[model samples]
Target: MKDIPEGCMKKRGILFTDRQQDTLTIAGLSLQERMIRTLQKAGISEIFLLPQQSEEAIASLQSTSGPVVCLTTSLLLDPRLIEEFLDFPAETTEGLLCVVPRREQPLFPLPAWSAPADDTVPLPLFLCPPPLLPLLVEALQQGVQSFPALFTYLQERTKIRPRPNEGRFWYWVRGPGDVKEAEDALFQTLVKETDSPITRLIARKISLRISRLLMSTPITPNQITLFCLGIGLIGAFLFTIPHPLAQIGGALLFLLSTILDGCDGEIARLKFLESRYGGWLDLLCDNVVHVGLFLGIAIGLYRQYQVPFYLLLGGLAVFGVVASVATVCYVTLRRKKGSGPFFTSVVNEEEAKRLKPGFHLLVKINDLLARRDFSYLLVLLALLRKMDWFLWGGAIGSNLFFFSLLGIYRWGRAL
Candidate 1:
């Protein structure tokens, strides 16, 4: 997709119609605020709001640039739909008076100059040249009070285009049920586009619920990271106790920490609160937890059996964990240096297919060994009182997996 120029739509103002009390609560934001935010995100900096009670509302909704296109508030518009207007070819947009249409009757009032239903079932969105504002006012004075009517008038008097609805997702925020649906749609959009299988199948759902409960609060993503870090450390400490019950507790806590870890990212994406510092903090905390947990398990096993081998095995496990992280960093840095940060190629299907078959096989193997989903196996081992087996498998498997990954990456580069 071609990148839309930043602030391309700022010159063309947005007009929002329909102002109702119920429109105030969609996604916990007032209709005016929602419209403004949606438009701003889509690179439309100027907005012309025409709420009900035109005289008083106009005074408050006054833009420094003045009203450009009058629109309705009862409709929740997807920003992408507005982006389409900004992306149209210059010739198509020149002197263009366009109305986006939906088949269903809109919850909000159509503009006084709207065309008839037979002409076009106009949505509460319009884009027109600023010069056309006077003609619109004249039509309104002549008792032309519907978007379809205005459209017909424009078609006869000027070159007007009726943009057909192309199945873009939009909602009428008419009541509580609509509000819930809008919120769910927004939440789904905020979910990370790339997620681990475990995250998608389990952790994300739980985390999303938690994130929604806390998103409106003062709590920030960094705070959630700190909370996850604390829980992880406590879980690691619990793993140091030489008892089956303690091991089970540690396992459960670790699982809880993993689930909670997702919430910080969820909240960050949902609230548009993502930050460089938050990303680094999350990475650092995860590594800390991994190191602590590996060492704790080793120490606990050594204490239980009074064996030096367990301590040595623990050291190897810690080394493997560190090496896995270092390998990924090294690969990412190398890719950045060579191809200007194609780190996404690690997950990109076309890039993966470009690799040699041997490397692809190793990649598949690494997925099974190194995925976060592997944590479930550890939890099972802990529950089964097979910590010794888990330690040995984790130490050997993790090192082998990462080393294999490094080798495969190099081989792919050579090919």
Candidate 2:
């Protein structure tokens, strides 16, 4: 949640549409559906499709109850970007905002004055307040048909600060090519900034394809999460067998688990099925698989070499992993004031700013070490007949991870 600016009024969504244009399909979903889903995810209080919704929404819009976000079906953009835009720190509740291309120099702190528009340029989105809704209704009654004419009319009455679209995404679906462009923007959601090299270059490519196919089916994201969790646990059990062949097989299965781990998120994001329970489940399942693999490796090594040290190393790894999970949960629920996010960064970004310079660098490296990319290395070691080496290194590294987080919790500004 963010701090609300004084006089900030919540906005309802008004999606102006042409029935034919709105019916145009992208990835099996209609454009209207996509637009509505985007607004829903952004926490819009009420969403109405105009022309279709004019009779009902106009009365509500005319009452001065709240502002409304007006956009048309002719355009599409990154939903995440719209979410951020809605949360942009506008100094006043009534100031208008015009969405423009990223190539334009956009005003920051939204309520600031915008550069003069060329008038020939077309804008794709708007933040229309209640005062303008009646005039909008009047314009509609008086034969203002093209959305551009209505936008021009509205801007002439009140100034609109330009809010530039983020990223290389905002598309106007005027032709077949534009719809394809919009689809490309939608697919871009599969790529995450936090992705590690292996996961980004390899695992993500595979998982995204799998997610695309699964999105057409009845299987839910949580189901994929549980299925992958089962696969991971089975692989861990295989790690307990003493044979070299078994070790290699277990490592292979483990790698598969790690790769598919991204699929659940991909599917959830694609269909807008993301949930708090799913996030918590993903985190818990990953940790369980991690602990299982550590214990299994120790047992397998002990059975093969008859060394008690393997068991001790296993205990250390398990302790480290459990302690780390508990610490993260504590920080998320207690310190951060909310939960349900995947624990990608052990230290939160805002919290990182307050740490001493030396500790900040150390925390960044530790956080990088925690990414799942190392799963690829474990498989490589297995192929080299070096499973014991992985066990040794992972044991030490896991303990180090816990201690790093513990230090942050105890001394850093926040964990």
Candidate 3:
């Protein structure tokens, strides 16, 4: 379990609406139903739901045996709720736990009572969410008791109880239905962790769903890798067809293939299903697709344009040499390390770690060119359809320059 924040309040319970939207309307659930769940779970004798009007809650407080807690919305409570709490019988007022949603500004006016000056002693009340009950109970077992409030509290607990031996891995194999929900929750938590929201929300959602489903099912990661490979092969075959419509169809399939290619490793990581064979399969399939795609595009472009066969052959040579060298280096390092090497850079000790801005500029230029795989493929398709040598030369030449720099960079780093 993750460590609780030091000095963070352990809330008694949280109250919130079922709807997570900005606008509010009359909810079908009454305050009684909402309060009843938390109160029963926390073993509280009385739950006072402070509606906009305070007559009944106030009346109930007058006759209650123990301290009374009121969970209310800021808009609904206003000054009246404070007045009601203050008017409650003397010792009972200390037990007054006010629950409200989080806010940028103070939701309501602070009551007259001051918290103890020492700050070490537990406060009478807390303000937090309802999902924290198990943690709160564990803390309570240690003879620590406090009050907390929360903006929104959900009473429903997860049905699939996790075990200590599970060690986070078993959480993945629990299957698809609840898996998506778990992924959504994990995404929300992760989003709150980073400084830059670099991961696009939709991409994260897709990644999470894929991760969950892949982990839960019996499907091997190699299957996904092979599927991508087969798609890429089909794309290459489609490119060889003489029809314009067929070329377009092939390009579409190739793009889909590239996108699906992103899911395999993500699934492995989420489920702790990492294996040597799976990693090798992914690496081999990825390179094979990349080569097959361009080779097929070159074939089609050559047939359509009938330009200098030398340029097409030259492009093929450049693509093949660079791809082969990079694949060899990556595979060699992986075999040596006994694991995947993509995320780990095997930099040579002799290489300088820092570079000047001029060098940086050059590096950026090269990276952009090298990253033009999709662009080149698109250009090849366009050229095949239009019989344009200028476009074809531009695409292949740019990529050649890109790959040349990549090879040099790899060699420099390896030195």
Candidate 4:
């Protein structure tokens, strides 16, 4: 969750009128509470429950020298929407900013910018300056219980502008059917632009199902990461055995570990538990598993073939992996300024142009290869009972990969 600091903006949210379905649950948390959490994560300082709020609460708003976000309890807002809306200075741009649905479907919360607002409908969500706080309190006290009625009262006083909706997700959770739709909308957010084709097409399908099962449970995202680490370590250890069956089993476990890796992120993002520490921890755990895998495979191969060179190759592979990973972590953690989920590598064509023209093609190919899709290849090699082939490739290819990463880092300016 990204927080907009108080010095930047006084972020406060208020649900003016309460609805009967305020307790309606979505993904184990109530719809209202989920909305509150979303607002708070977006850096809301104070959230007010109007009509039911104490005199102190009303007194607090009178002193606000900044904007306040006002919404109804009936709708479940998208976090993206709230964050974007906060960026617009409703206090100065317009006396008030209200986001309306498409004229065709007023009940739906999502709308295109081209879709004109139908004024007959009420304001589900809006933002206003502190000067209008008295009107907001008066509306509720005057028995403007319905959104449509409240919309009229506000419009009569304040100059309201209909803002465009920039988000892909949000739901009007008024009933039981709406609750299911809201949950589905939230799940759709797990899809990301950075997902590899293998993870997107195959692994994500399974991981998302697992995430759904664990979503409502008491288990946290960090807990899930540790559990997967244990499973992956066990799988890595299996590669130390000389037998083909153990090596094959280890490969399968490594692939399983790759699939399970998707879950921690999904859980973290869904619950707004994403942090810089969590990001670093996840990346570190992955590198640790990779180290175990490379060494274990080399040890197994050396034992089976009685070759001393395999041990040397393993040492080189480990060194390359560590060097490459250190560079990426250093760039992402220290060099990069702002954050979301960090993009480790896989530069776009334009970004690749920073390097030599010849390197451009290799960078494109490498970006495609970077998507963790290689786990599928590993499983395929294990099925053929040729684990040495993978170790051989890992030994040589790992070093080449490291050099390519080094080149990219050295050449790129903004990376």
- On TM-score, the leading prediction is 2
Candidate 1 residue runs with Cα over 4 Å from true position: 1-23, 34-91, 94-170, 175-177, 190-201, 327-345, 348-371, 404-409, 413-415
Q: Ten consecutive residues with minimal summed lDDT in candidate 4?
A: 108-117
lDDT measured at residue 312 in model 1 versus the true structure, 0 to 100: 91
Model 2: residues with Cα > 4 Å off, grouped in runs:
1-9, 87-99, 102-121, 130-134, 140-146, 166-168, 175-180, 335-340
Task: Evaluate residue 126 in candidate 2 and report its C-alpha lDDT on the 0 to 100 scale.
Answer: 71
Local accuracy of candidate 4 as per-residue lDDT tens digits, 201-228:
8899889899889888888777877777
Rank order (by lDDT, best first):
2, 4, 1, 3
- The candidate that achieves the highest lDDT relative to the unseen native structure: 2
Prediction 2 TM-score vs. true: 0.86
lDDT (10s digit) by residue, model 1, range 1-415: 1233443333434343544443566544666667666676666645544323334323322222222444555566667776775555544432343344544544444354456464555565666554454555555545554445655666567665556556565666665557677778777865554566777888889988987888668788889989988888898898899999998888888888888888877676555455656765776677678888888899899989999999898888888888877776665554443211122233346558678766776676665554456567778999899999988986897688667867776777522
Local distance difference test values of all predictions, in order: 0.64, 0.72, 0.43, 0.71
TM-score of every prediction relative to native? 0.69, 0.86, 0.46, 0.85
lDDT of 3 by residue, 1-415 (tens): 3444544432122222222211221112122342344244344444433222234433332332233333332122212233333343332211233333333432233333232343212212332222333433333333321122221111122221101111111111112233344345433432212211323333344544565556546776668889989998898677666568777777777766655665666554433345667766776677676666556666765666665673465365446545644655664554355444232222222332544234444544443433324533564645466523433554465466545555445543433
Candidate numbers, best TM-score first, in rank order? 2, 4, 1, 3
lDDT of residue 29 for candidate 1: 61
- State, as a TM-score between 0 and 1, how close model 4 is to the true structure: 0.85
lDDT of 4 at 131: 59
Residue-level lDDT tens digits of model 2 in 1-415 = 1233455555787777877678887654677787787778777878877666666665555543455677777666566666666665435444345555333432212222345564323345676654455666676565554555666666666666666555535566765656665676667767988887777789988887777677668888789889988988988898899987888888888889988888888777766777778888898898999999999999998998999999999998899889888888777766543323557687777787778667877787787887777788888888887888888888888888888887876877654
Evaluate model 1: give its TM-score: 0.69
